[model samples]
Target: MSPSVTDHVVGRALSWADIPRLVELEGRLFADDAWSAPTWWAELAARPRRDYVALESDGELVGYAGLDLAGEVADVMTIAVAPEAQGRGLGGELLALMASRAREAGAAYLLLEVRDDNAGAKALYARAGFEVVTVRRRYYQPGDVDALVMRLRLRDERDGVGDTNG
Candidate 1:
């Protein structure tokens, strides 16, 4: 069953055990230069990725994303929605939920990297209040693909967001 309209989409916290699915999705989405299972293993084993969550729908894993909560900033270390799940608004929903989690952690801003050629993801971030802040060349090795750095400012209680102290 779906969450209530006011409840927002829910993502299941994933463990290293979910590595197989994560790696599989990464390969399907990134093709030849995908992040290996070990990369995700490292992420899952890390403290920050402990909060990473996978979005499930129709009893299947349709998307996955993570947040690294550092003192006052949250980083979107990795996020991927399965090919069959792309084009749906699920990515944007997952982003919004991640941003909300950052805010809940007292993070003032969120940062992430997106492949420069990913216009769809860029647009998704833009609509979510993120802006292109910088660019890193040859960030994706082997393919020499560039990465666009982006950030989103989290809304505070003063900004009419959920009460920071509440």
Candidate 2:
């Protein structure tokens, strides 16, 4: 990813003061299945290994995402873009940022579990260099859908090639 595109928006650790608006975006994008306010707070505050970021456009938050880094492994926890901002490459941008953070933290691999039904999210991760590693049965609630576990190696490096991570 190029820094030029990153300049259009800014990402920073989520602040407790931004919780209300963050909840609003999460509710709108994830419906009732979104993680609770307390969860976000803990990830942003209590968890030293977790990295939570909010993507803002024009001074208003349009998306949010977070990753949990464990040693040389990182797991993408949540990523949601406002419906209005969908299809603008924001998801990819957010993933790139998270992956970059993962690499900078010395992670050798990144993992994510996506709903089997969410092809859009799966595609984004694939394009970012992730591959399906396994599946979890009846992972999501309200509809017993399975979850696809995907993995991407961050150790691959080739000069002049665009590494998926921003």
Candidate 3:
């Protein structure tokens, strides 16, 4: 098994200083669908409603994730791991961080959308206990790729469904 991100990386709140690096990584990782620098700035400007985390190894940023908390629901804005840092469980750790943050904010559900072509990411989300709630046909432009809307219930105990507090 690969080393877990927590074994060697330090995680902290993401700051303005990370925008350039994040944009670069987004360009590399998401290619045609990468978020622009201005979009990132807007996301940061949203303040307490939007929360983000950055992970560093040896003082180099390796991964980051963001969440948008809105009442009983929280949406995952994005999650990215540098190419060199992939397969180290950093993605899962980042995803867990988002989920935990959402739950802490009293969110009952967490939602995210991933391109259907991204098998690895879909697998990661599935392993993290997310289920496909819907599919947006041709949601990704240019290539016309489909997007899978996945959701995880953060607080389902009242309906007799097991809580995901673990």
Candidate 4:
């Protein structure tokens, strides 16, 4: 079920202290594809180039997202919401936050790769104005899932052509 108005869901900057919990959530959310602690550590160590955000509901971590800002183009590194929080509007909220950050960082475009099998995620990206740029065959290993490379034109938002709010 979705959270109610009194749920107290909040978004904040992600920190090193939240890594352990993020790892736990990654395991549950991504299974074999989940990133390891060391990888997360490296990501955190990247500093200004990489930005991350965490979401909590009633003081408990429920979602997280990260972006890699690379001047003209910003890429979404990851986004995951706990199973219990799925289908709520939290994923969109997280996405919107990332898009806003990318815009503020002077990114002209936002890019992301989503597994083709993840219909929900694809739908979310589509709803946020991301268009499939290309498809990478069997990009995801073990299960051999295809990856859809998507891009959103953040530059258009500056000219009031598109929604940068994701």
Give per-residue CA lDDT, model 3, range 108-129, as digits (tens): 8999999999999999999999
Report the lDDT tens digits of candidate 1 across residue range 126-158.
888788889899897778889899988776546
- Sorting all predicted structures by TM-score, with the top scorer first, yields 4, 3, 2, 1
TM-score for each prediction?
0.82, 0.87, 0.91, 0.92
The Cα error of candidate 4 at residue 103, in Å, is 0.4
Better of 1 and 4 by TM-score: 4
Clashing pairs in 3: none
User: What lDDT score goes with residue 158 in model 2?
Assistant: 52
Cα TM-score of candidate 3: 0.91
Question: In candidate 4, where is summed lDDT lowest over 10 consecutive residues?
Answer: 1-10
Give the per-residue lDDT of model 4 (tens digit) for 1-166: 4536247455588888998998899999996689889999999999789998888987889999999999999999999889988787888988998888898898888999999999999999999999999999999998999999999988764474545664
lDDT of 2 by residue, 1-166 (tens): 4333344474777789888888788778775377778877787885668888888876788888888889878999899888877787888888988888888888888899999888889889888889999999998887998999999877666532335548
Candidate 1 ranges with C-alpha deviation above 4 Å: 1-9, 48-50, 156-166
Whole-model lDDT per candidate: 0.76, 0.81, 0.86, 0.87
TM-score of candidate 2 to 2 decimals: 0.87
Question: Considering every candidate listed, which one attains the maximal TM-score?
Answer: 4
User: In model 4, which residue pairs have backbone atoms overlapping below 3 Å?
Assistant: none
